[model samples]
Target: MEQYVGLDVSLKETEICVVDGSGAVLARSRVPTEPERLAVVLGELAPAASVVVLETGGQSSWLHQELTLRAVPAVIVDARRAKAALSCLMNKTDANDAEGLAQLARTGWYREVAAKRPETRIIRSLLLARQQLAKGRRDIENQIRALLRGFGLAVGAVAKQRFETRVRGLLEEIPLLQDAIEPLLAVRRTLLEQSDGLEERIRDVAATSPVCTRLMSVPGVGPITALAFVTAIDDPARFKRSGSVGAYLGLTPRTHQSGETAWSGR
Candidate 1:
């Protein structure tokens, strides 16, 4: 018997419900959300089911990847649309949500979302780590500027290398504060080194990938930004229009409209 499964997943557990082609609930249960548990449960009941519908949450990608590898046909549904479908239901529970998802799947009413590719995830993590290091380096530079300002000493407009050298000399002259600020200078140095290494890796990634290089050609796109954009967007063809890309990046303006009059820029 062919079955359709709907999974309402949270961090700790998932509520699952299986429905037949006739839309009759077959089996409903709660299972641990871990990949192993999910694989086992989905394998045991209705192996290679008709279709499995699951909402897109933080862990949806992980579950989707595991289920796909196990030969389970799963589609990650958009959570907002799923919620709107259940708006009529006054009483909402995980089980109820799971049941609703099953019905939605059976009717083919929900939007299907794509999961991230493995290589994209790896590149995204690396780029994000580099961004964190850059922020930390900025914080250290600001602290040093504030410290110098306290003594009415202004570090002149010099190149980064010369600026650091002058600050080191000034710190050495004031032995009392040298120990405190020297550690910060060391941290700044380490951050600079890490940032440089990350930049080299990002450039290499962009050079090797045709998609990344093409995205870099766009206006306002650099190697770091291009890498982030390429890694996050696994399938550019999915977007029917180029304008959708701006909306995805939150660059599009919001608007409210009525029957005749439309308001702009919300």
Candidate 2:
């Protein structure tokens, strides 16, 4: 009797359910969320299980990759789709969700999501860090400007390089204001240094990547933009047609149609 497996994964534990080809519950158990432990439990309970389904989440990508490495046929399903199907049940519990997922696996009625490679995730993280640092620097600068304005001191329209000098000049005679704003100026300086370092590293990575280099060749496409585009796409092969790229990036409008009426909107 062939079997199918479903895993309702949480941070620390996973609820597992096994079912036969006819969708009859064969066994159910709780195991640690670690890939090795889950693999061991599955081997003991459903050694012949042909498909194991899990939902997409923070840990799903790592678990799916690790399980595949252990020779388990792991499938990552879209959580939204799985939730829609599972909502039909009266009782919402991990065990019941596991059973529903097992049945979904048996009937092949779920959408499988592709897990991104670790390298791509790393690049994405760098981009996010750089963005946060830039935002933080801007926020600090804006706060300094606002605070200085409260005392009728306007450090207006100054270049970034001269911002600290301008602030000091405006607050030179006000000892209390100087004391209040010096710490913030120091923080802004550190943010500037860190942001510059991150940008340098990002440019280096983009320069070395053949894909990013090609993307940067387009007019107005800089290193940062090229790297972001490359990381966002991850795999070019996923798109069958180049024209569909605009839709994938959400640049195209959404369309709505009925029996006779049709409309498009952002």
Candidate 3:
């Protein structure tokens, strides 16, 4: 009998449930959340051609990739959709959710998602890290402004390059204020350097990537936009139809004929 396996994954444990084509429960077990452990359980449960289903979550992508490495076919479903489907269960529990997922698998009612490649994820992580540094530097600058305001000093209209100089000029007479804010300025400088370095790395990556390079061909699409779009989509083949890309990116129609919905703009 063809079996369908559902895994309700958590950080510490994975609750697995198996069901046959007749929608009868076959087996349920708890295993460590590691991919190796889950693969072992799957091998034992799925004797014939079967499907393993899981919802998108923090670890889902990693699990999917690792399971594929172990020769296990894993399907990732949208968490939001899965939640809506599982919500109708009379009594919800790990086991019940697993069973529900198994049923979805057996019926092939759920949509399967392409897991993001590690390279794409790595690019995104770099972008995020750079953004974090930018935010931190901005916050420190704002804190310095607020502190200066307390002493009736205004750093109005200062350019980015002149910010540190302007702050120092204001603090020349106030040694105590300089002492207090110098450490923050040092930290901000470090963050700025790191952010710049990350940006340079991103530009290099974008330059080398054929997809990003092609994306940048469009007017106004620079390295950042091209790289971001490429990373966001992960793979162009992810969507069966190119028309679905706009919808996936939340680009609703600007002008509906009845109202004002149009989808012309990129």
Candidate 4:
């Protein structure tokens, strides 16, 4: 008989439940959240049926990748959908949630979301880091500009390459304000340097990736946009229709209707 498995995962521990065909509970256990421990539990309890269901969560992507590597079939369910289904239980508990997930697997009632590739995740993280550094640098520059404004020093239309020079020239005689702003400028320099490093890495990624190279050939599409599009798409062939991408990305018009309320084209 095919066994279905459910795992209610938490930060430190996971509640697991196994059910055989016809929805009979077979075994239940709680184990450390580490993939190795979970894999061992599933191997012993389900053996031939290591396929388990869990809800999407902060750690779901990482856990899915690790479990798949260990030869365990891990299925991620939409958290909202899983919540809606599990909330109907009379008593709410982690163990009950696990059982509910097993039942979901047994009946094939849950929708599966595509797992993100590790490469995509890594590149996306780098992009986010680069964006954060850029924002930080911009904020520092704005703060410096604000300080200069207090002294009636209008840093008017200064190019990026000349921003530091202009600010220093403006404060040449005003050592007090210059001293106050020097630290911020130093921080900005550090942020700018790191941002540039990340940008170079992203450019290298774009240059190495065939898809990113093609994406960059289009006007207005640069390394960041190309990388984001490639990572978001994951697998282009997964979409049956080319136009479906717009809908998938939520760029296309969508309609929502409730009792006496209708909306379209968000």
> Relative to the true structure, how large is the alpha-carbon lDDT of every model?
0.84, 0.91, 0.88, 0.90
Winner by lDDT:
2
Tell me the tens digit of each residue's lDDT in model 4 across 78-128: 887888889888999999999999998888878887788888889989999
lDDT tens readout by residue for model 1, 113-207: 88987777788878998999999988998898788777776666777667678787777656677766788899999998999999899899889
Error of 3 at 228 (Å): 0.7
Runs in model 3 deviating more than 4 A are 90-93, 253-266
The deviation in Å at residue 174 for candidate 3 is 4.4
How far does residue 68 in candidate 2 sit from its true spot (Å)?
0.6
Model 4, total clashes: 0
- Per-candidate Cα RMSD to the true structure, in Å, reads 3.9, 2.8, 3.8, 3.4
Q: Give the per-residue lDDT digits (tens) of candidate 3, residues 116-229.
A: 998888898888898899899999999999999999998999888899999999998677997789999999899988998999999999999988889889999988888888
lDDT of 4 at 266: 71
Give me the overall lDDT of model 3.
0.88
